[model samples]
Target: MYKKIRFLTILIFALIITAVLSTGFIYSISITNAPSKNSTSIVKDKGSENKAVNTKIKKLDSNSYNILVMGDSLARGTGDESNRGFANDFSSLWRAKAKKPIKVINIAVNGDVSSGLLNIVKDQQNLQYIQDSNMIFISIGGNEIKNFRSTDASSSVVQPNNEKAVQNSYLKNLENIFKLIRSKNQNSIVAFIGLYNPFGDDLTADKLELLNEWNYKTEDLVSSYDNAVYIPTYDLFKYNSQNYLAADNFHPNSAGYEAISKRIFESLKNFKN
Candidate 1:
């Protein structure tokens, strides 16, 4: 951007000088532009700063807490090649800030719908893991809308229509999740990362519209429950698609995960009873 501005400045100056000499005009124009030498210098400085941050992240952490991460692929770090999804990476950072160990159990499976969560709930063994948990982070619901268990799954796949029935079902089950958690640990704080638009620029206009509608409904549903805070991760990746998502464009990348983690962390105060 600075280089382009500098070029435009030089071009304008040249035209001004030419007009002055050719027309014998006394009028002169002096265009003040960003120094060209500083443009590359600034770029180099940015690279250095980014490198410093990267180096800082290599250090081991020291803080401790019992953290349980549940839900879907985002919780599992699906898009990350290094598998440093938001939950793992954020737990590491939290440990770095604390003085004890942070016990983290991530029981998140890919393509876990709401039904899958219920099935997990039915299994007493799985629920025992988080019985003494200090905190739980969840990112389910995408799969609840997506069903792939049938023989004609491809053609039979009927995602949520954002209608009253579908919306109510997700909301009631979400409430059930909270109620179940409350039953286990009355004071455990749960944070649900809200769904965002998953369509690439490839989505049709109608699809985008439906996505927005469903996202809004989901937000409301999550907010309706007590002890459950729904953090919106949609807008983070909606416009800046490339930087926020994985190659599949469905799951979030490292940056996207970080953004969501940071938002929930910022809202951590509300989780306190």
Candidate 2:
């Protein structure tokens, strides 16, 4: 009876040991498979860090200016010897006076017409620029007028019917351009550079009249928008045609662009008030 009791005690002890060992093994496996507290914290911290970086990259300061320049050869600064078109010059002038940060995105195409510019602005990249910009400058309509002048040498004659059709089409394109710009960015200040008569020296009376009419209509359109302004180049080049005109006799030279830059800078002053 003593031996049997001793054997029973031994058996029970072995069973308890086995149970404890099994439990310890299971716990070890669980610890090995589960994610560590430190690792989880690291992952969350990395995600938050990325979010902060993105936020910083996306937000612009209040004093920052992003300028978007669009339209034709004039916008491209094609005739300027220094290659800094009116847009760049204007940017420099603004930077000097405002002493603030500026970014200029000039997507102006040489010889681009209003219709062409409309197509360009429709592009995704340009739309993104337009959305980001606070100041927008457009130099168009000159190519359209030039095309008309080229085809009809008798434009000097008062052909109201034909001229009316051309004007209508041009105005329609301008309306669409303005609508597209305002759709993407409503609060941005828009400045439309008006057409100048390059043929002033030759006394192209009919061209002058047409340009004046076009500018008048354009200014009217500009007035419709509270934040939009028409920067008239007609008067700038009209009296000083010899000095402002480039060798091409169409686009403005460096000096001419400087004058335009000054005018644009001055015009922006009114907005501050």
Candidate 3:
């Protein structure tokens, strides 16, 4: 009887150990299958970060304005002491008035003529800018006129027939430039800043007539396009050259750029309306 009791006690002890071991194994599996709080927080943080990034991108896409500037020294703001040419000035003015973010992409090279600007527009990178821009500002033909004066120095002043030829060639290039720009971007407003007489009263009446004629023809050409307009600067600088021209007597000064920007800003407002 004592032997039997001992065997039973040993069997009971073994069963208790097995039960405890089984309970431990079940507890280990439950812990393994449960999600960690840290891991859950990390997943939530990642999703929140992605959402914030997407929201910022959408805001930029919907509210930002892009401007593209093309052509000569005027576009480059060559003589401004502040170095903010008319393009930058216009951008700032517009930004203030519109209260929106503005991005300006000025690719204008100093001394670049109409044909040169056309080539620039044809470039792939510039074409992409054109495609994405909301507005395009162009300042050209001044260099072409300079080139003519330098080459045709035999007469000391521009001859009528020679000026006509130059004007025709410039107009053709201008048309082609517009064609290329419109091909890339149909909705963007194209503003061509007209030539101003830096020489003031020193320029001969005949030459001045030719210059006026050039502006007239240019305005006429610009009017042909539904989305294009010519912003005349002749009158702006013609009577105020002493105050508006830079020390070089060629480019506009800071005040002159401000004037141009104001004019452009007004024109832009009108265009938008």
Candidate 4:
């Protein structure tokens, strides 16, 4: 009878261990999957910061629509061998899904910043494109944080103060950007692409926290616009960064871009409906 009881105890312990592990695994998935929908905020109070309420711009008056792509190397397809980044893939899918002809004007430079994007939008010709576009995609701010590293070259730790400063500057530039674009084209739907750390498994817990903070602020800003949306790529690339990254280990490769495109397209579809 003692042996029988001992065997039952071991079985119960094993079952408990399995249940705990299963719960943990499920919890991890929930955390990872939740960000995609959570990143998009449809609020309309961005005017407090810029004093310009996002005007509800009309959709393209014609069957054909323009899509203006702006921002850094990620926008320019730096890591993809085919040179067609996520935006390009997204454009193709969007054209097919929307059944509308799309004129894609991707002027994103390989090393552009939010300030650079502001300048580009400030240009008369680019402003014309903005004015004509039905949609715009801005992918910036990652460089602001990615360019800075910890005091130790080998460490992934980001100083809190530095991160704060970077985020502040990024948010300011983004505000100005929104103002400029809205000033030119009140009807264009602006989609701000959130950041994804390419460091993946190499990224420390502290660094990941900072990245999340960046994403949260980005979503907040995007939500403030009546005609804006935030597309979260952090979770998309979080677990697959190493495999999705290009040879340079910074930008997303073809597979990575495809994944990002699908997510952005999903958001666009929902927003349109």
Cα RMSD for candidate 2? 8.2
TM-score for every candidate vs. truth? Answer: 0.65, 0.72, 0.73, 0.72
Estimate the overall C-alpha local distance difference test score of candidate 1. 0.67
Q: Score residue 130 of candidate 2 by CA lDDT.
A: 79
Model 2: ten consecutive residues of lowest lDDT: 51-60
Please, what are the lDDT tens digits per residue for candidate 4 over residues 1-273? 999999999999999999999999999999886757645544545445322334333344466767889999898888898888887898888876556777778889878888888888887667777888888988998777775545464554355666677678889999998988888878778888888888766677777777788889889988998879999988887788877899988889999999988988888886662
- Per-model lDDT: 0.67, 0.82, 0.82, 0.81
lDDT of 1 by residue, 77-117 (tens): 88886677887766765655434687777888888866667
Span of ten consecutive residues with least summed lDDT in model 4: 49-58
lDDT of 1 at 257: 79
Model 2, 37-127: lDDT tens digits are: 7763322354476544443324334567888899999999989999999988998878765556888888899988777888998886677
Global CA lDDT of candidate 4, please?
A: 0.81
User: In model 4, how many backbone clashes occur?
Assistant: 1
Per-candidate alpha-carbon RMSD to the true structure: 23.1, 8.2, 10.0, 26.9
RMSD of 3: 10.0
Q: Return whichever of 3 and 4 wins on lDDT.
A: 3
The residue pairs that clash in candidate 1, if any, are: 61-96, 62-96, 63-95, 63-98, 64-100, 64-101, 65-102
The pairs that clash in candidate 3 are none
Give lDDT: candidate 2, residue 264.
Answer: 88
Who wins the TM-score comparison? 3
